[model samples]
Target: MKKTRKLIYLLEDNDDIREIIAFLLTEQNYDVCAYPTVKSFNEDIVLGKPDMFVLDVMLTDGNGIDVCDSLKSNQKTHHIPILMMSANTQMFTVKEKCDAEDFISKPFDIDDFVKRIHHYMD
Candidate 1:
């Protein structure tokens, strides 16, 4: 039997960036669900859990670190791998606090982004 494709949940406020990233991941044969805010993401959580989560550091509603923290703390979702992206140079401090599985600074190379995702998936 064929294996089911893994799903990736992406929480990004920027539409252009989100589309580009989604396109990249889709090209790589991963299913992606993109959300512009935590509120939207929360609504989808009940529908299904993705194999991994890609979160941005900042959002119009609040910081993504809090979202990551909540997911990591939740018994059902804690084991899901998180890949966090941030434009802030201070993101390392927040990353340390959140204990995310992986982090990427914004204005990042697409190759590096894909590589990191592949690394974590492995």
Candidate 2:
């Protein structure tokens, strides 16, 4: 039997950032399903659950904190690891509000980013 790739649901509003992260994760051999808006992500999430979630703190339509809260509260998706990313200086407050497994500051090192992802994945 063929091994299945881990699916990651990524929500980042910035076009460049979304593309870059998606590309980086793909190159690392993980399957990524990226979305720019919360509405779009919400629509697709009902179809399937990802092995992990990488959410941006600030979004064009919605904030990732609330998304994180919703997912954590839901019985179906509560167990999946969520990694929150932000360039915001107030991430400490953001971190306290959500139940994500990990938090990473933006402008993060590429090597460190991959390592964090693998930490939860493996």
Best by lDDT: 2
Query: Using Cα atoms with residue i matched to residue i, what is each candidate's TM-score against the true structure?
Result: 0.95, 0.97
Q: Which candidate is the best by TM-score?
A: 2
What are the clash counts of all predictions, listed in order? 0, 0
For model 1, the stretches where C-alpha displacement exceeds 4 angstroms are none
**Candidate 1 structure quality by residue, lDDT tens digits, 1-122:** 99777899999999999999999999988999999988999999879879999999989887789999999999999999999999987766977879789888998999999998888676
How many backbone clashes can be found in candidate 2? 0
TM-score for candidate 2: 0.97
The lDDT of each candidate is: 0.90, 0.95
What's the true lDDT of residue 32 in model 1? 96
Q: Residue 113 in model 1: shift from native, Å?
A: 0.4
Q: Output the lDDT of residue 88, model 2.
A: 84
10 residues in a row with least lDDT, candidate 2: 86-95
For model 1, where is the 10-residue window of minimal lDDT? 88-97
Task: Give stretches of model 2 more than 4 Å off.
Answer: none
